[model samples]
Target: MIAAFLGMRLYSVLGRKAEHEEEIIQGRFKQEEEARDVPPPTATGADSARVEPVIAGFPPAIERGLREISTADRNFELIGFMEGAKGAYEVVLEAFWQGDKEELRELCDDDVYQSFAAAIDEREAMGVTLDNKLIRIEDSTVHSAQLDGKIARIAVIFVSDIASVTRDKDGNVIAGSLDDAVESRDIWTFSRDIRSDNPQWLLDETDIG
Candidate 1:
């Protein structure tokens, strides 16, 4: 009877200890799982306050104009605008060469579209086609930027190498050679109405850089 009583006392103590250890291990595993599930911390207001606005590399006058434009249009981003301007330059040149009036109409304002259309008409009358290829854009920069009331305008200067050939109706190369690339510098202005919901900017003006 004494032996049986000792055995029961030992079993009770050991069982309670084992159950407590199991509960502790289970709790630890749960804590580890929760830690793994936690998301990374986002930037807080104080952290964001430490960040500065990016400055566009330009002259003082141009920077002031850009600032005004930025104030007028909250969504205006200089880098994005520069990229878009470069793309537009290529697209407009290609469209003009191919005499794609519909595409030019969408990209240019009324006056600019009229100018491109007139050039296309003249080219068609001469029975000459432009076989032009934009080799590469060497440089592109914002020459000027301004906010005129609700309309924001930005002019970009693009320097590019282009291989151009004038082909006659008989497919004869007449003027330029494809082997020779010419450096073309052009200033193109893009304008947008900040109050409008449309995010697109139209080519409003063009000039030799």
Candidate 2:
């Protein structure tokens, strides 16, 4: 009779403890499910806005240069050469957008290439960050041309803005500067001769201010 009484008490105590543990586990599971159902915070301000489209186009004179795009004759190839030069200009725009030096080198002439590369190197050395937000081919005009002689000159205008942030050696931003989104128009001259086997014309010169 004594043994039966002690066994019954022990069994009652264990059953209650098991029920308490089960309640704690169920409570924890409920809290976790509630957290999972909660929605994430929404983004605000400009961060939520859509990005603007990139715009690029050439002037009327480019069509005139395209006249020589024919491969049948050397004279016609001269026109192709001018068109090729224009294409190089477009390539430079792409490089600026992508922040790539190699791409610029392929399209830029020796002197111009050195100037641009040096600027990039200096900025990198000083921890300066550069951002080119916009590049637009605004206008272009034909300066002079001699299609029969396989030589042409054209002026292309482009507008672009650059933003720079200067940083210290420790990579801390010190000075930030932005060129007031000014209208920058560049005039690029192109020339080539018929007798020259070189189908691609050189960038004779450029006036950028």
Candidate 3:
């Protein structure tokens, strides 16, 4: 996971899928389940049966984009990016819950920052506090990826279990059960300016599935 505050520059700052559709917004918030039955690349290179760079699980277009990303950013690694996404997910949730605009600023784009800030403000104004916890990240996968001009973006799906509870100023249980962990699916897009010195991929957009 990223730090409580995103102060690290480059990769640490901006670095980091779903089911149901025809259009795959590689960098936008869209959903579609591709050929997931295909397996990932295996470690057993001696066996000629293993495809070195497996493309079985990804849709063709997305697979092509992944190749482009690798060509564009030598530092890009599918596994590393997946792990980074997990951390970023946790950081964003914690920051949003705490209404930490400073932390959000470094991690998300201006529009997203404004949206989260507004939501946090509204929740606070209502004299309500949310206690949210990420119980576990069950799965993570890429839904789409693309490069527009010098910008590169990838949308990912995070399957997770979360425990949450909301309380009024009087501390009365309001929404969500404190004891139950709810399953959730989130699609988020992260983008980075490939031509720039900045390595951070900002949180460009999000959608719930």
Each model's TM-score?
0.74, 0.45, 0.73
lDDT by residue for model 2 (94-143), tens: 45434577755544445444445555564455444444434444544444
Descending-lDDT candidate ranking: 1, 3, 2
lDDT of 3 at 41: 17
Report, for all candidates in order, the number of backbone clashes: 0, 0, 5
The residue pairs that clash in candidate 2, if any, are none
Model 1 pairs whose backbones collide: none
Q: What local lDDT does model 2 show for residue 118?
A: 57
Best by lDDT: 1
Clashing pairs in 3: 14-200, 14-201, 17-156, 17-157, 26-145
Candidate 2 C-alpha error for residue 112, in Å? 1.8
| Cand. 3 TM to true fold | 0.73
Tens digit of per-residue lDDT, candidate 1, span 1-209? 32243224323321221111011110010111132242111111222112215435578878888788666666666665666677677777887889898867766766666667776776677677878899999999888878888778788888999987777788887767789998878787777777866566777777777
Instruction: Give me the candidate number with maximum TM-score.
Output: 1
What are the per-residue Cα lDDT tens digits for candidate 3 across 1-209?
11211212111222222122122222221112123221211111122123226434688898888667666765556664565666778778877877787767766666666667766776677677777788998988998889777677888888899887777789886766757998878888877666755444667677775
